[model samples]
Target: MPAEQQHCSEKSAVTNSSTHLPVRAEWLATHSEMALDPALPVIDSHHHLYDRPGSRYLFDDLLCDIRDGHNVRATVIVQARSMLRADVPAHLQPLGETEFANGVAAMSASGIYGDARVCAGIVGFADLTLGDAIRPVLERHISLAGGPIDTGGRFRGVRQSLTWDADASLTNPLYPTTQSMMDEPLFRRGFAHLAPLGLSFEAWVFFHQLSRVAGLARAFPQTQIVLNHCGGVLGIAAYANRQAEVFTHWKLGLQELADCPNVMVKLSGLGMRLGGFAFSDRERAPSSDELADAWRPWIDTCIDTFGPDRCMYGSNFPVDKGSYGYGIGLNALKRLTAEYSRDDRANIFWRSAQTFYRLPESSMVMSSSNR
Candidate 1:
């Protein structure tokens, strides 16, 4: 194993010695509240499926959240290095994740997990440094995802995240700082292959790197780019006391990014540890109203810049579950966008993701329209 992966494995073993802390049913039950606008359709645009030593969130965990009274009809699975075949070559390891996700999709399709279609879209990782040679890897993923088959084919995009920082404490050591992965000639060459394959690109860079995303969008105007975690606004470590400065910088960068018509923003991940929400430190989890108040400025700025059509709400679950329950996390999104028109709300909750991922039209319909 690489030093980073080995280190992470060792750390996870240590952490698992205690207990997995997230998705605690008891803690979430304390904040029991009815689903906000239960009729609203939702397609959780970004989430993960991982079974680490300390934390294991897979099909059952996802089903628990989906059945929490919200109308989550489908979901998009983001890559998280789970279920990778250890026997495979380094480049081919990501296929195992897609295969794992496809199995989850198959399970959800059996109607055993209620109406929510988990892993309706699969966003796996590929080393874009391979440049054009990455095509074969992508084709392998598509073929394994069932190609054009209706029941299992849901390979949507690639998410080779560039979420690195020089401050070691602020970033994952596995993704060491690259300074400019997005601007690299080799990376661009690999990224250029997506549009032709009808695949989108999920950019998971931090706030300081938004300029690189902007440049990428401008360069690949035909390709669809989804900005993960609202440009991954960092509020931890060196950024902890610099909220004001970060906001100003993030806002300006967002405005520049929005100038690219093909790019969309995911309104989620605010509850993450790196986001600096501090909700988990409280005596009790925050209510929807409190979360809405805390997140309004950033969410409003995204909506104002990208409009409802380009802004979709993602749960970023299991990751966000570290701080808040799935119910509370999604309810916060509901509370945040309550002031928008019904159509706009629909766009954020589901339509934007549906269109962006090109998911099945039949599966995207709202279960109940009486709200």
Candidate 2:
């Protein structure tokens, strides 16, 4: 067996007992069956890596999930401020995240973790509010990501999250209470710098803010922008009891955003706390079928509007782990897309991510006919 497989088997006997704040291994173990269509290739378009006070999901944790029965051939590491360097200047702190992700990519490439190349694309954080000043930071990320010890050329994009709300409980304390980032002149100026450097922008905003992202996409048609978490649909706290009202507005916003061809949507994050699914509060985990049924409307809307080529599946893992296991999460996606044509399903699973991130063609698991 491969070294990674051997290691996984040894640890399989030992259940995770860590009392992490958001993700409990005991809870995830409540449902253990692998999903249907396990052979479908996936790129896991969005996930995070962190080692924090109440939570810690490192390389091993990620690999364990990848080995949990899906053909996850690659992954894109989204930023969560996990490993920023405290020694660096405030703005330069994000470079350390890229460096750390590239190191993880290097480890995955060693073949010890099977063929799935985790962090095949690294999307680190950068404050685009810096305007023109953000250029050097972008260069630094590019340089470090392409350095000798890093992944050869997997650094793809930057994500300056604008996920916020007026309700204090719903918003991340670290983020400013801004109404719209796209309207900021300084932010727009900084966003313009991305296209010239061949970097894509990963935009994370609430469903209400979809029009803002649509405006940004229209303003900078040259830049490729990815809409993270199905445009960050909220169903928690203030928005909890009004699911019907929220969905009506959310669908309208999504339709407007879909008019912008430069944008793509990541079809995941349905299990997030912000969505108010409350999957974590259940006595036992829901099955893949249950997950598929609940997420179908939103997922189908994105696929129908964006088309399969512009819609890709994402795990949003460790965060999504708060509600469901990695296998069940992905299995739910498989069940959701079961009716689509083979090519459409392939696009949702892996091809869209490969094209959007500009991941190397050699890393792709294309069929002999395509070759």
Candidate 3:
């Protein structure tokens, strides 16, 4: 028998290692089964690593999470409001994103994360509506990120989230999405600049705005537009009883959006603010299966319309932790995709993200072999 297998057998007979062996074995076996392809590398297409309370989320935090849980070699650090100087353009007020990207680079420099560099292709912030100033803001932010380490051409893109709630009270600076941002000409110009820079655009909006996204996708055929959170559908009060009708409209809107070859859908953040499973008085977290169930129809519709190549899995991390932990959410997504062939599973979870983000082969480590 192989040394590892022999050792496992020996551990089964011993009391101390025997006690721990079952848990280890179960974990290893689960990981092995979850992978359809042992060769394809895994990239969490959408995930946020932040320094919030009661969670391990610094650069090293993410490294340990990736190393301990699965074969995540590289991660794209989406902007989660890092500790940056406050003075910048009003629209570009929260400048902490540059620092966060640099933080990921520093962790890479520490090199304790095996071959796993934080090849964090950043989707940093830029107020594309600023037109002439948009390029300058991007350059300034890029300069902030490039100081200590060679970023490996990892400045992948920008995400100007346009998530508006009709209820005027829903205005939170943390997530700013107004109807005006979508219809404005200057913002379109800002979005258009991305194609010239070879950067992709990440869109975050509510379900009603799916039509607008379809419109934007049609308008900008050159920009690789990624729709976040299954178009941010909300399934709580006011919208709760309308799931069927809402989803049907959403389905049709997504189909239209998918017609634009440049658009992709990220299967993430669905259950976070969307409150079907999170409406309890005590805030009980939904199980992986529960989340997968809630997200199934939307995800399936998106895959059917956009095709698997344009779809990718994202944990949406700490925000999702409000409802499901990273491991749980990923396992849930994996379970939902269990029926797929290994190649298809690989594409949904990892491969498509790699191609979309332009991550090199060396940056990813497959979980099948990790076991």
Candidate 4:
């Protein structure tokens, strides 16, 4: 609750054993037996892989996960703070994440990762406050992704988080709370730079902020914008008796976002807190149905508003992994979308992400026949 400790300390101490420890193939294989395939190619539009000294999200683990996971051909690797070295300048503080992706790209060149490659469409950071400076910041991010460390070279966009909320339960206070960046012209000037480069914009805002998101989408029709985490709905103790009121507000806000053509949504990352699913010792995991119930309305609404062509699946991994395994969250998505036609399912699962991230259909090292 203190300002110094704003981040939720769910799994704070990720021991070396927890990092590099192999997720037994037998366990996943056995779990796979209960999993149903919608027979679609899925591009998890938003997942995070952090690096610890003895961790497995390194190149070897990433490739192995892709090979063992469902029909994934190409994926867009987003920035996490794995490479945030202390010596980098404050303006360039975010570039460390971009550098980490480049490292993933280099290892990708070894040609062992089956058909799924770390498609180079990176969404690094640019401070919207430094209007003119943002352009170069973006340019530097792309350059970093294209450097020798990155063999895949998929630089695509950036995600400047604008989630500022006064409600303590709704956000991590140490990080800036819920403020809509789109409402500010200075930030908009920085945002305007992405259209010409074919780069997309990723947005992280709370449900109350969706109206402003709709406004941003209208202002920048050409700049593709992706909304993360179902507009970040939160289930606070204050709303225990009145869940519907918050959800009602969220539903209406989402409708406004659906009005924007350039804005797409990623149906992930609500299970931990917003969904009111509790897990203490890793044995009391939430079921797929529970996860699906919390998100189905929002996901279905986004699909109806933007259609399946704009909808994409994302794992929100490591974060969600604390509550459920990678395969579990993904299986919940499959279950949530089971009612749709095969073609529609394919679009939501992969085709949309392929076109969105500009990932190649074929791989030079590994063969991705699923696409």
Query: Candidate 4, residues 160-192: lDDT per residue as tens digits?
Result: 777766655555443453364577778888888
Worst 10 residues of 2 by lDDT: 12-21
> What TM-score should be assigned to candidate 2?
0.92
Q: Per-residue lDDT for 121 in model 1?
A: 89
Better of 1 and 4 by lDDT: 1
Q: Give each model's clash number.
A: 0, 0, 0, 13
Residue-level lDDT of model 1, residues 70-153, one tens digit each, is 888889999988888888799899899999998888888777767788888899988889999999999888888878434447
Which tens-of-lDDT digit does each residue in 1-371 have in candidate 3? 23333233222211111101111222222222122232345577776655433333465445534543455666677776555456665655545766667667667746665766674567777778787668766666666666212345667778877877677443346656668787788888778778777788898877778889888888888888889877777666577778888888788788778778888888887646454544122234445666678767877887888887888887665455444434556667777777877777777877778788887565664444532
The best candidate in terms of TM-score: 2
The CA root-mean-square deviation of candidate 1, after full C-alpha superposition on the true structure, stands at: 6.3
Q: All candidates' lDDT scores? A: 0.81, 0.82, 0.64, 0.65
**Model 4 off-target regions past 4 Å?**
1-33, 52-57, 60-69, 147-152, 177-180, 279-283, 363-371
RMSD of each: 6.3, 3.8, 8.8, 7.0
The runs of at least 3 residues in candidate 3 whose Cα sits more than 4 Å from the true structure, single-residue gaps closed, are: 1-40, 52-56, 87-95, 147-151, 169-171, 279-285, 365-371
Better of 1 and 2 by lDDT: 2
TM-scores for all predictions:
0.91, 0.92, 0.80, 0.82
Best-first order by TM-score? 2, 1, 4, 3
Model 2 Cα lDDT, one tens digit per residue, 99-205: 99999998987888778888989998889899999998888888888832134677788998787778766666665648867789999999988998888999888
